[model samples]
Target: MARFAISDLHGCRQTFLAALDTIGLNKDDELFLLGDYIDRGPDSKGVIDTIWELERDGYRVQCLKGNHEQMCLDGTKDPNWLPIWLKNGGRETMGSFGDHMPDEQHLQWMEALPHYLETPGYILTHAGLNFRRANPMEDQDAMLWIRRWSQEVDRDWLNGRIIVHGHTPRTLSEIKENLAYLNHLPVMNIDAGCCYDLPGRGNLCVFHLDDQRVTFMPNRDR
Candidate 1:
């Protein structure tokens, strides 16, 4: 089975679908989505709907939690967090819901998402690891929120397993450069800023692990 990974969809539902199509994703393949699935761009609800549809149709999709999802959960519980979350793309997310609110099932699915996943050959997280800790896995907060943690990657702890992650947006060219050196580099960030309509951004990237391929899909959702 082919193992693939992508990150930071950020509410670009149609773009995400296109990426899956571009890769010719099938039931036999495993798709691991590194977080930030919501907030920013449009169709946050639609994005989640696609995830659910994949599951319903027997696709093997694994998801990690992102900082925005955590903020959304907190904002749902406390009025104080509403402003902070709204300021940070929550406004557009709420707009996606329109007349309805996120049902319990959706919230539970997000809440139950793991912060990271470790396979025999790679470690996947929403954000980079905090190598400052004796065991970087102990820092769950950093998994969801940290940035610039690449400089601190504990090579000894990582051993030979490549660290795969997203949440930090890098340009498509930069991502391709990383893919080219996947054999030498210990970490790869696949987020091409699919939702951002700026220079060097706005393309969703898919990383096929076993095949060592990169699939690019433009943002037509926005």
Candidate 2:
């Protein structure tokens, strides 16, 4: 059985599917979706539907919560949060739920997602770990939206495990500078900016843990 991880799908259904196909995933392969599954694209509904379908098919899919998902949850608590969520590509998410409306089941699923996950050799989060906290387990905010914290080098954190993250989109090469060390354990960023253009192309990254390989799938956008 193989294990793989992906991040920041951002409702790019085609790209998401393309990545899965490119990776040649099997029923036994475990897929870790590093959050941001919805928003900023034309097919948020499709993204959710596909994820749900994948789960039903016996795929061991682990999904984390992203900042966008947090905004959505906050919107339910405070009506004022709607504007901010909408401004940040929430329109697509809203459109996806069209007429269906948010339900208890959906809310529960979003609410249940953890801020971070620890596997045997990797730690997964939407953003990165908090450096200020005396203990990494104590900080929730840092897991949802941290850039500077992940960039810093700490031998303790490095020796802990590989940190796989999204949120800050940069090329695989670009991540080299953001990382604290080059020779030691490395941080892997899978965002690749499928929602926005920096490298001017929408792309999805696939990391095959067992094989120690990285694969890329071009977004359907261009």
Please report the candidate that would top TM-score against the real structure. 1
TM-score of 1: 0.95
Q: Write the per-residue lDDT of candidate 2 for residues 76-100, one digit (tens) a residue.
A: 7898998888888888777777834
Residue range 1-222, candidate 1, lDDT tens digits = 889998988889999998888888999999999888888879888899999899999999999999989998998899999889889888888888883446687789889999999876899999888988888889999999888877677777888889999888899889988888876668899889998998999999888888677888989796
Candidate 2 stretches greater than 4 Å from native: 99-101, 157-160, 175-182
Error of 1 at 14 (Å): 0.4
Error of 1 at 210 (Å): 0.7
Clashes of each: 0, 0
User: Ten residues in a row with the worst lDDT in model 2?
Assistant: 176-185
Could you say which candidate leads in lDDT? 1
- Which clashing pairs does model 1 show? none
Error of 1 at 193 (Å): 0.4
